[model samples]
Target: MSTFDEKLKLFAVDLYKINAIKFGEYKTKVGLITPVYCDLRVIVSYPQLLNTLAELIIEYIKKMQTFDIVCGVPYTALPIATVVSVKNSIPMVMRRKEAKDYGTKKLIEGQFKEGDNCLIVEDVVTSGSSILETVKDLKNSGIKCSDAIVLLNREQGGEKLLSENGIKMHALLSLTQLMQFLKEANCVNESVVEKVKIYLQNTQVDPNVLIKNNRLKLSFLERLNFAKNPVTRRLLQVMCDKKTTLCVAADVTSTTDLLNLAEQTGPHICLFKTHIDIVEDFHPNFLKHLKEIAERHNFIIFEDRKFADIGNTVQLQYSKSMYQISSWANLVTAHSVMGKGILEGIQQSEGLKDRGVFLLAEASCAGSLTDQSYVDATLKLAKQYPDLITGIVCQNPLLLEEPGVIQLTPGVHLESVGDRLAQQYNSPETVVLEKGADVAVVGRAITKSADPAAEAVKYKEVLWAAYEKRIASQ
Candidate 1:
């Protein structure tokens, strides 16, 4: 029910309490005397705690989609995987270290197909040798293992070893997170916390090198350099949360009218999209005033010029033109048809440092080439100049389902044949619910209404209702 960060905070606090009561100097199965230990086995005894944790895991997996088949690695992970599978309505699998002579003489005991993308779940990984062996067995059994989810990572070579074997380690809690949790809960002394921090720091590993050595599959960010930017990531998040974002595509006919519409709808929206060439009297003063209003009301001014010119020409239009896009707009929409060189020019401009360049993908308007040649071009540009791009402008807001691209859908309305006007576009509610539209851009519905503020409120309420419904369903 809570946000990811909130759930993690609560888990840290609870885990700290459990650890304090159970941990002390003890001989581990690995034959090492440890001052602190975690027996998440205790969580099984506390049904409420176990349920909460299962719910959290389900929520996280649903959001991340990091795994295809959820397979627990041996004993401790089996219970956690079972609970999570029941909560999320997904099937579970278990991996055994060695084949049992009595039962089926099988090491992997579950329904799984060859090359199924499987995620191994574990309670904790210390040396990681056991999990590596488990991974080897799974791979030998024709299951593709690329990811591992664990309760805690001790910040040791375990993560590196797993990664070296082509597996990513996703942990709900790390040693650092646990140490901080213990300190906040007053379950451990400052000296013990310091020792843990020092131990983790000294044993830190580089994930990039490990990933390379294993010839593992690259993550979304690694595949597309554009996704590494923080601005791009934030824009993607805005697009994903169907409630707070409204993707608008208005013809820039009059600055005053556009500004008025933005003010009326801005409070409930995240992006106010525009086509700068359509504006009648575009000037620096008008641009400055519009930017001011956009900031005041908590929305981004997205210039939808769709510039498809040479590098020099695009740079001039962005900085020296009457609109002065670099000065006013938080994000500028551009056509990647001009090649990566033009995108490089846009990025080289100092004034456009914080500005995001949303690439034109599947255009909202009909008779556009986005479906055929444009889509391929956009994908290539997205890979080539990912650092300069922010998001993608498309009618299929569902494309925003990707981790890095913000899906901006225009032509949204509460009621109008406007849906007929753009035969394929979705209504505001439909866009939010079914299409996963981050921002619903409405034009005539709000700006042309008798009472713009009231109309905007109606749209906002509808968006919120859709958001609540989706969250409830989840």
Candidate 2:
């Protein structure tokens, strides 16, 4: 199979080639004249393309853990849903637009009976009213309807409406994404995208969530004052804003590799974390390029300095060093051994208020010195400097509930054991989901992949899925 992105782009391109999505005033099923119309019912003409659609829906069903049986909304989605159910051997069902008057004389079609989990599949969601009708029929039959899948979400309050009716709406693409792909492929221009945006903005159920991907990015100080920890807030905010919760730890020894990785995969990450002192042949030019990558990619620059000195000395190290860390980093890591004095010292630096710091609540080294007492004291110390502290580099999720304290767990890998030197490692699932870390800091696992960008994409999917499950449980 192709990469997830390639599949979506290809699906849309093939659909456009067939003139499935046409631009012109047309009457919708609901009786509204619209400038554009999507007729996915065209898939019936191409079995090969229809098979791909089934495979894509199956991919999402497996990833999302959505349904045991698939049901089509009795129109364009019927063929795809039928193909998916039969091909995958999943039970298929549907509520007809009208009850049959002939043999069987039934409103519901399919062998599925009552009390089965049904997933509603549809071509598009404009207002979500049609799917709700299917849900109503399913509920009448005592069958549960908990999820709906769509090829395209119109971004017209349909998702919010479905969610309100106790169904999770999963779409392969949204209007905003479709616009982006079209513009990138030169299929449409900026003016056309702007017009589509205007149409979508008027159909929002929650305008706040739709305005810029449901995020309100805060400045360093604003993040501090947030109800959650600044680091947690930052991580979640980035995930919501950029649709990813993966951060790359540029652990390479060469500045060349570091910049290349950032430039190539920057858009998929929430932050580019670096140990500036370790990069070979590092210079002001290195920092300049690194800063540029972060700016262009919309990710934060995190210097993993792990400062352990007294506040006064650490302050100088953060600012006056040959590298001049304070000039570029949006955040840094520090150890909390000296209590409030460590934070007080760092905060004393000029222009430091707009930057944030993550305390070393615990380390990943096996049997290292940071214990429960240390973590508790660190939490206490952090509260005293709420304005300056963002979160902690924690192995344990002890500080999660403390207001505004985000836990960022390191030592994550796709596969690996402890290093010969005694450093431990955990999978992204272990650290992000099991330990409740807001962000997963990964290094060689991704950077060393045969294809780093594809590897990063895989990590993002798993991490974001786990994050969604955690949020639902909460």
Candidate 3:
């Protein structure tokens, strides 16, 4: 009998020989473009490799627990489960991706009692969605499933997600192990290995960190892991590191006042929103100083330019005008009323590196024009430009159907009910905790306070406290 290492080496050799493991640009099920692809289904055509894989999985599972029946996830793992069951003399059950329309309508096939313990088998695990779906089905049928075994673990939060749901995960080979074997065997080049390593590091999602610091729901984190927008990710990272989801709306008119507000509130905010065009003393030096303060305090400059115009006009307004808003602002606001062309225009800006846009879905002012139809259209347009649109500026959180997009609630104040200008307000607890807002945009509450810096700290603490409470309740 060969050692586990010896068997794994031979299996890797066979995998490359049959072209089951290919090196190229392949998009994963979670929408990540990976450098290497592992098609486990190809193993079925090679009987020797299939048997070796079953042996490896059975050996790996031996350390876990003994179960009454083994259930394969679906189309791909059924054959592998059959091989494992026959060779080990273990009873096997099968789960249908979709039950038959007419006969019996049973989702699970084979003989199993209500209290039987079933082990889930899978070809590969990425986000563990398939395994979770299979577990849901088995649980509904009153069968116990406390363990799952997979041929390959992509190391992309699958283990953490499964463990959170009370199921232990066992894998025969992880992506790191396979990469190391391939590199040692000279099957893949150094560049391929490096690319895979980089991708894994960049895309790896830690549910614990996200929940602990960011206070984001697990379901939201799963989608956020696959988001293509770098700026969106950066915003979330800044919020976590700063421990604040407060965006201070600097509604002042002079550069001095704006810069003062920024300096005072910068340490307590993830974003310093501005209306640069509205600055009475706007100049090149103002932006330079503002950017310096932003970098010093680890906050992003958000230009609240609710651009609503044709593509050509907006493009010039964003990049070419005297303001040149794209040169410093990390994020900008836009109205989807103009349609996809607005996004295309923003994308055409020359200095638009690592920038994102938030679409105006609803307003907090009295008698605002943003209706349900307008919000639906805005979200629909935002979806078409996922890489550009990172969030929706709204009064409520209902517009957030996609977990990848965040919600920013404006007009948040601690005590003010309604301003003379018809600006309504909500408390930090109400917006961040009850409304599920990612960032509570507070304008007058912080900007108009006597001690702006002290006021900023108050709002930050309240917002973060509410966020922690919300996640704890969840």
User: In every candidate, how many clashes are there?
Assistant: 10, 3, 0
- Write one digit per residue (lDDT tens) for candidate 2, span 1-474: 359877888888788778887776776544455565678878899999999999998887887775668889978889989999888888888787544323563557777767888989999987677787688767767788888999998776788878877989999988788778777777778987787777666634452332212111222223344533344455556667887778788888889988999987798999889888888788787777887888788888888998888878888888888877888887889888877666776777754346788898877777778877988888888888776777778775565335355677888777746678777777676665456576778787888887888888888888777776655532
Record all residue pairs in model 1 with backbone atoms less than 3 Å apart, i.e. clashing: 226-386, 245-439, 246-439, 246-440, 247-439, 247-440, 247-441, 248-441, 252-278, 252-279
Residue 417 lDDT in candidate 2 = 67
Each model's lDDT comes to 0.66, 0.75, 0.83
Give stretches of model 1 more than 4 Å off. Answer: 1-227, 230-243, 248-252, 397-401, 419-424, 471-474
The TM-score between candidate 2 and the true structure equals 0.52
TM-score of 1: 0.49
Q: Order candidates by lDDT, high to low.
A: 3, 2, 1
Q: Candidate 3: misplaced stretches above 4 Å?
A: 1-216, 219-224, 399-401
In candidate 2, which residue ranges exceed 4 Å CA deviation?
1-235, 351-353
